[model samples]
Target: MGGSPAHLDSPMVDGYGKLQTNGLRFHKRLTKNPCLLDCAQTKEYMLHVFRDCWRARTIWERLVDQDKWVGFSQGSSENWFLRNLEADFNSQGVTRWRLLFGVTVWQLLRRRIDRCFNTEVFGRDPVGVILDYVLEVELAFLNNKNLGRDST
Candidate 1:
């Protein structure tokens, strides 16, 4: 059941795989580490890349703890977002804020991969990028909602 296209093509799964592959390849080439070049994929590595990576941890902590936008369970990105959407909807944040959170998290993951893989320097701060993305998305959502209100 979890192997369906809905699961396979999820942004979280795709993003995680892409980031993990890019990160592994970049580190191997940069450091000339043969061990990394042959490293097998694992769930632990994917979790580390998505959640515990030094760059990404701060954003996860802030969103889950400070903002209360997410829960505490460690799971795939798709599961996490789906669970959070339900919780947020039940909590009455469903209209716009929930969508903003979901989209921002997805964007943050992609941005992290882009910054890491596309830059001349290898190390990029995922947490900082996540924060910036969250703010940008939130502002856009608010602006759009306000425009709708004014038009109505």
Candidate 2:
């Protein structure tokens, strides 16, 4: 995860896909269902969590334009992460698509883990939560710009 942007999304030692497979593993949480939403009886694997999950799709919908949704959502999962990370825009013309994408993935996984541990907050909105995290990180990065931080 240190040298590659794609490595930042391996779902290893992280509450991303395999770890949040409806509690089938990762210490086996409260439920062993197919999905945290409990609406799909399918295994919550990496691709599912990244692109197919209903909740994840919702987050993508809010971020991606309808015209580009198909391209952004479909295809081999291997190219999915890399293409998105290399993208220069995030539908809204935001040049920081990579940052937004990374933060959103992290927040999605974080929310999944949180739901597994805290059922009381199951109604949480992932899109809003993820964007908030993205905004915070973006702001911090912007603040550090021209401040000798990127000189490394």
Candidate 3:
């Protein structure tokens, strides 16, 4: 019950202004450009990078239900996270919806880093690949929990 906020901030655009150090004076020296996607120049906000960007959109479309996607993608980052953390029993029909949510966003950020800073490496469809990995981990965690409970 302690994960009130996750470090899902995007230092590139949204978090740039939140910095208070004297560094803020020369913050312009930092890279102030497109989002992690690099090509997505319109909005460099954290919301766009993690949820609304085309790259994130494709993955969320596959991972989230069409009925909830609209609301899920809307809201201040803090509210979006608070709701996800306090949400009911299951999201993707799994007991740990918040875990699934966290992992998906983490993977999205990792992917963004990979695509921008490192070499992109995924099979035919990268989105599908990431989705599969996230779901697989969710199931693995459930299985591990079941195994622990069974032995107890």
TM-score of model 3 vs. true structure: 0.63
Model 3 agreement with the true structure over 1-152: per-residue lDDT tens digits: 75323442444223433322113323554434333344436435566667777877777776677777777777897787788787642335645667667777777666665564457575567555655776788788789999999998
| TM-scores for candidates 1 onward, in order | 0.47, 0.71, 0.63
The per-model lDDT (C-alpha) reads 0.51, 0.68, 0.61
Task: Summarize candidate 2's per-residue lDDT along 1-152 as a digit string, tens digits.
Answer: 35545534544434443343664643454455544464454456776777788878888888887787777887777888889887643665545888778877877777666666666575657676667777788787788885767686
How many clashes does each candidate structure show, in the order listed?
0, 0, 0
Say which candidate scores most in TM-score: 2
Local distance difference test, candidate 3: 0.61
As for candidate 1, its clashing pairs are none
**Candidate number achieving the greatest lDDT relative to the actual structure:** 2
- Candidate 3: misplaced stretches above 4 Å? 1-43, 88-92, 146-152
Candidate 2, overall lDDT? 0.68
